[model samples]
Target: MEALGDRESWAAVVKEEEEEEEEEEEEGDSANNIGDAIASTDDEDALKRRISAHPLYGKLVEMHLDCLKVSVMGDVAGDLDHHETRYQQQPKDCNKYPQKMLHQSDLDHFMEAYCVALSKLREAMEEPQQKSMAFISSMHSQLQEMSAIPIAHSNAPAHPLPPPTSSSGK
Candidate 1:
């Protein structure tokens, strides 16, 4: 089955298989229509609850890639256009100019920025764990308080009981 018998036979078999799959996917009688599964949900609140309960719902990184560059004047403009002339001018010794491609200051700035981002990610990951630990500690204290209540009651001196009534005359 792995070997193609011939172009005509293979094409015929693939076409037949594709048609079968398309038919299966398009069938309205089946309740497992993936395209309509989420849309057909009757309860919006339940869907939202389920989505929020997802582990990665709020943890995924949201990237901003659509920022627009605005033209600036003065030193800021010079800084923005600093690399334009470099790209326009051809280097004399391109092979020996690796240092020109990247400066030590640039590397240092990159490392600092990377460390900041790494620390931020670590803090984000640890925040939930810290909150859960605090909750557990509070619960532990409450349990201890509850258990101590019973002990305190047990340790209290017993109340004096009234003397038994004298037996009636025979």
Candidate 2:
């Protein structure tokens, strides 16, 4: 009788373990379904997540910013630390650049030029612009004045930017 009772208890234990495993699998499937639904809702967000997950994302961001700086201000030295390619921590020198410092027209013009170059580069590289756009939007949001950069205006004309002319005439 005791042996039979032990057998019955072991069967009950096995059943409970199987039930727990099934519940855990169900929970995992539900979580995956939720994730898939969310991902499907916003493809851009999913692209951003994947881009940021890349091991060299930080380096890519820094390099992109450096290229942007060059596009904006020409290739002058001393803006970034050489070893780490990090921006230098210099005190703001508004007096030195009174007319040129973050003027709306200049910012608009430079950014437009940069966008043209970026599009060309994207085409040459044969990579989708969604990844680059995600990085750019993220960087733009980090700027101190949100209005410094322009998003599209409803009334604005959708025209392709002209090729940027070199001031150096090169």
Q: Can you give the TM-score per candidate against the true fold?
A: 0.29, 0.25
Model 2 residue pairs with clashes:
none
Q: At residue 6, what lDDT does model 1 achieve?
A: 82
lDDT, candidate 1, 46-82, per-residue tens:
5454333333322221110001012233666465455
lDDT of every predicted structure (CA atoms): 0.52, 0.59
Top lDDT hit: 2
Model 2, residue 168: distance off in Å is: 99
lDDT of 2 by residue, 1-170 (tens): 99999999999999999999999999999999999888877977745554444433344555565454444333343454352353333333444433433344644455556556765654555344456778888887877465654556434656768999879867
Stretches of candidate 2 above 4 Å error? 43-170
- Which residue window of length 10 is worst by lDDT in model 2? 83-92
What's model 1's TM-score? 0.29
